[model samples]
Target: MTDAAAPPGEPEAAVTDGPVTERATCLLAPNPSMMTLEGTNTWVLAEPGAREVVVVDPGPLHEEHLARVAATATAGGRTVALTLLTHGHPDHAEGAERFAELTGSVVRARDAALCRGAEPLVAGELLLVDGLRLSVVPAAGHTADSVALLLPADRALLSGDTVLGRGTTVVDHPDGDLGDYLDTLRRLRATVIDDAVRVVLPGHGPVLRDPAGAIDFYLVHRAKRLAQVESAVEAGHRTPAEVVAHVYADVDRALWPVAERSVRAQLEYLTEHGLI
Candidate 1:
């Protein structure tokens, strides 16, 4: 299932369009629809005046998409020098191997082994490919392995599923923790308040210009939702589904299933804290 033949949708290429040879290119994943928000976004960061590029999130194991990524990097007079994964989710890493094979680039990530045939990306790692300097920042919570990339020159942050352009992300249980997620959000807020980040290139949805406001809203929203869930549980909602019914009474019923996952995570958190 390469990008080209990726079931009619799925980002067929790692990088589509951006400032061209200026620096970075953004390719939207075809895996769009209501559930995924918009779709996963694969970005290509190239060094100005250089012929080498860094690929981010190969996007699903689709062959056509992989070929497109290879071709796009070539079109920019750049070769894929490295592959970086923000996380190990299938949508972001599944196509990494095939794409790497196509471009002969090494994979760089926090857990390189999660990325087929690549090395792990450690914190404070500085990747200078073709002259572009990328700083790796560990952004856990969305997932324990999630990482964020900072392009200091552009004051930009490449936030994977740890944050979204629209709406708040689920603090899924087992791998995701509400407390940890809040801490991560606070860290991001620090970046925003410090003016270290002016723009956010999220994994899904459009790029966000108001990173501070967005993060603040997410924190407030999550806190409110957690309170609501707590109140619902206190009101006799025993299961996740029941909590969803009470906490999300006005939300679309279709979203209940997804809400249930979050509710369950909250329940577990509460139980661990002896609040249940």
Candidate 2:
């Protein structure tokens, strides 16, 4: 096992946010760190012929950034009419209400508490914004209420933290369930295969042109990590921290806390599966 799971030789996403499909433009946030590789990505979606656009993930509560997102959408005489959140993570949804106020749009999210002046997003819900259809898919890995958007028109997927553009996403323990995370990845993989989704617009990092490859990488990485954890446990690493020290020895110490959270989720999953 390696300290970092290699990204299948896929191109690393650019540090700056960039355009994805024809209709989606990513507005990168100012915040960047180990967890938030580049920063939160605020995606603005619009049809070429429409005046109304839809903004996804308003990012953090930075006033200037919020204003920038509004301005970007309103460029070329287009206006933002709807705001959607992939999840309730602060980096992704913290500025939603402010962005809604800026664009005079309603904010919608899977978590009811995250919704403002709009109904919670439902799984399988069909949304028609600017003459484009966005099919909501329940993701719920990084968080219990996480979701990813499927744009059939462009064959693009707006995946939140569930499927990032860079490294493997953490199954955030307590709130993040490893079992459900695996299910979500499997489901997304099936969508990539059956629907032929070509592009992945992640919540962070650069846009992925190879959706299938990214999904396959995530699924494989998760499986390999689970096997390593099982092996570590069978080798007498009974605690999550002990397992982390053994299985993630090569990983940076600063990330051990985050790794422990995922390790806990993995332990729970193994226990449930009777693998330890």
Candidate 3:
């Protein structure tokens, strides 16, 4: 789910399929597209010298990718004790069940239907797995079920699709609410400051070193887009398609369809708040 391009000066590290931090390693999935920047990031997280590990967002249902993630998580006598999904997007959670089966781990997600062998994730839930502390932070609006994991020990955030490494994410209207998304961003900005978060281990693209700055950019970008959408609507761009053509003209045509979802979300927000 792509949207507006990332703002300038947002730091992006060169992402590869390897260890990103002392407690986290990334396994880039095989699936890559305009929607998924590089690919869905299958993150393997564990404490140093710990025998148990946690895997997050097991990418697509591709057999090879799942196998790789399972292998990476279980390497050197480590056991994959838990599987967590950021959301139910196929690109992020489709392979979770198979991954759990492979590692004998239980899968947990905000959505009950997506959970396997475990209860759904709750906001503010602290998961203590093998000395690793991960706090479940509700991050709805990328999808209603999206949840971000905060690895406090490392001062890192496992930001599903709520925040991306290289570009803005789609609100994906109806299921995604712009109002909720805006609120989420504001909350995340505060979290970044209060927690002193150092890095964002995103689901796509690369790791973000400036969590606060990136979030601020997202907020500013959203405000700008909302203004553009409002202007487009007032300019007699009656339909979403017309609005997309007008407001997202700088974006790729192929991505207009995806951008339309966010435009609709923006329109809904505008209407609800009497800003349109």
Candidate 4:
């Protein structure tokens, strides 16, 4: 899910499809909307001088986009060795099968159903492709199967929808849990501190330079929103819709449907912890 709010203190830039780092390039997809800011960011990652590269989040079933991702990954005579998904969201994984067909690469994801010709990703597993080392980090909040990839060499974290480049991501309730998301955020904060992550290559919007600061903002934002939800509940907001209308009245009505999902997750969290 996506957030309508822009990231606080982040400098906005023209988000285009191009290289964001020495080892990473972002191909901005064509699909843009209130949810998908700019578009889904399809990342191409490889170690410098490596003959094989990995593609992350193939994006929607847009044929041209998939073809472009394949072309970009296979440029300079390098082969697209693997396709990885941050989650099973259609915006991120819909093009996986098509892209795999175009690039002849194995598709791997946390969800077994999403994997094609490859095993599901195991948390903490090191994916050594050519010379690039990507550490699979289980990030289950946006979705049960969401994951983040850490590129130690580049000090970069490929944060799918868990930590967006701009604004925040939706905790798609039922499938997503707020408690789990909060835990994921805390874990990611520790990972950033311990691993010295400097940049975040998000699934959408622009690249984030200050990984710690971004995550801190997300944590603070979540806490504030949770408090608001709890207050709304105490103030007689009985349903998710009522909570959304009360807590997220300022947010675009177009986003309320998704916001309700977050409220549901938060309500569940509060109920489980006996906070409400």
Candidate 3 local lDDT, 145-203, one digit each (tens)? 99999999999999999898888999978799998998888888788899999999999
All candidates: TM-score:
0.87, 0.95, 0.97, 0.97
User: Ten residues in a row with the worst lDDT in model 4?
Assistant: 3-12
Ranking by TM-score: 3, 4, 2, 1
* Residue 39 C-alpha lDDT in model 3: 91
Candidate 1 residues lying further than 4 Å off, grouped into runs, are 1-17, 20-22
Name the weakest run of 10 consecutive residues (lDDT summed) in model 3. Answer: 7-16
State the lDDT of candidate 4 residue by residue for 1-276, as single tens digits: 444465654634866478888899999999988778889999999999999999999999999898888888998899999999999999999999999999999999999999999999999999999999999998999899999999999899999999887888999989999988999999898999999998889998888888888888889899999999999999999999999999987788989999999999999999999999
Off by over 4 Å in 3: 1-3, 8-10
Position 127, candidate 2: lDDT: 97
Number of clashes in model 3?
Answer: 0
Model 1, CA-based lDDT: 0.74
Q: Output candidate 2 Cα RMSD.
A: 1.9
The collision pairs in model 3 are none
In model 2, what is the error at residue 265, expressed in angstroms? Answer: 0.5
Report lDDT (CA) for all predictions: 0.74, 0.85, 0.90, 0.90
